[model samples]
Target: MAKKTNKYIKPFKNIFVFILLMFVVWMLFFDANSWLIHHELNSDIEDLEAEKEFYKNEIIKDKKAIKELSTEEGVEKLAREKYYMKQENEEIFIIEYQDSLPKNKEK
Candidate 1:
């Protein structure tokens, strides 16, 4: 009979090292607070932070608009432009050219 030796099997022969490796693997992948779970949570936090920044910018813009509309002229301009309101003696006429109309996709 010939004697056989394998270099790879030497370390795992120690019971303590094998158990330590198994514990590390379990903590990294199988535990409730695993590395994979933490990575997902971090990504979610990044998304929420970006969303918070966007809302903050929107609030600033809204505050500026509110300040502008605090005066009578700004309110009237907004009403006339957006809501198509006019003074009692004035008439509003809206003209649409061929290019200004929305094209139909059904054709």
Candidate 2:
């Protein structure tokens, strides 16, 4: 009687199972739309979504400010503070914070 030997083949799992595992592994790492690619694309999508939300909030704030600026009082307030506009012959005195003042040099 001759003894048969299966050196490389595993008897526990079928060939089909081994091939299926290999295919899955290849797709996960080496394929074009792999797991790593999917993860990076999802991260990009989340960042873009966050940026979109930020810009949407900024747009809403800008629209509200524009509506406020449509009024005379809003324009006067903005001009007075932002541009430091004053009436003719009006003297404006600016008070600076203590921290903002120049430090004294030791003699």
Counting clashing residue pairs in each candidate, in order, gives: 0, 0
Model 2 off-target regions past 4 Å? Answer: 1-13, 102-107
- Where's the lowest-lDDT run of ten residues in candidate 1? 2-11
Give Cα distance to truth, residue 44, candidate 2, Å: 0.5
- Tens digits of per-residue lDDT, candidate 2, 34-66, equal 999999999999999999999999999999999
Window of ten residues with lowest summed lDDT in model 2: 4-13
Clashing pairs in 1: none
Cα TM-score per model: 0.89, 0.77
> What is candidate 1's lDDT per residue for 23-102, written digit by digit as tens?
99999999999999999999999999999999999999999999999999999999999999999999999888999999
